[model samples]
Target: MNTKDMRDLDDAELADHIKTVRRDLFGLRFQHATGELENTAGLKTGKRDLARALTIAHERGIDTNK
Candidate 1:
């Protein structure tokens, strides 16, 4: 998802998306460990997307530290 799309999500939705992305990241890591990952670049993209979502959430004062 792009920044604009990420920005459109409300705090609760953003949190849900974060959880989903983390699950995906874990699966990706497992695939990589098993040497089944076909696209290594996807791992980087997922991480960056998660970071972007978290950054946007922080900028909106979501108080993620709670």
Candidate 2:
């Protein structure tokens, strides 16, 4: 996902997307370990997406310290 796409999601939606992305990341890791993942580049994309979402969330000032 791009920054513009990430910005369109509300906090709740972003949070949910983060969870889903994390689950996907876990699966990707398993596939990589088993040499079943055909696209290794996807791992980096997922990580970047997760970081983008978190950065957008933080910029929204949602009191992450809590």
Which candidate comes out best when scored by TM-score? 1
Q: How close is candidate 1 to the true structure, as a TM-score?
A: 0.88
TM-score of each prediction:
0.88, 0.85
Q: Which stretches of candidate 2 lie over 4 Å from their true place?
A: 63-66
The 0-to-1 C-alpha lDDT of every candidate, in the order given, reads 0.89, 0.86
Residue-pair clashes per prediction, in order, are: 0, 0
Q: Give the per-residue lDDT of model 1 (tens digit) for 1-66.
A: 999998988899988888888889999999999999999999999999889988998888885543
Candidate 2 C-alpha lDDT tens digits along 1-66 = 899988998888888888888889999999999999999999999999888887887888754332
Q: What is the lDDT of residue 14 in candidate 1?
A: 88
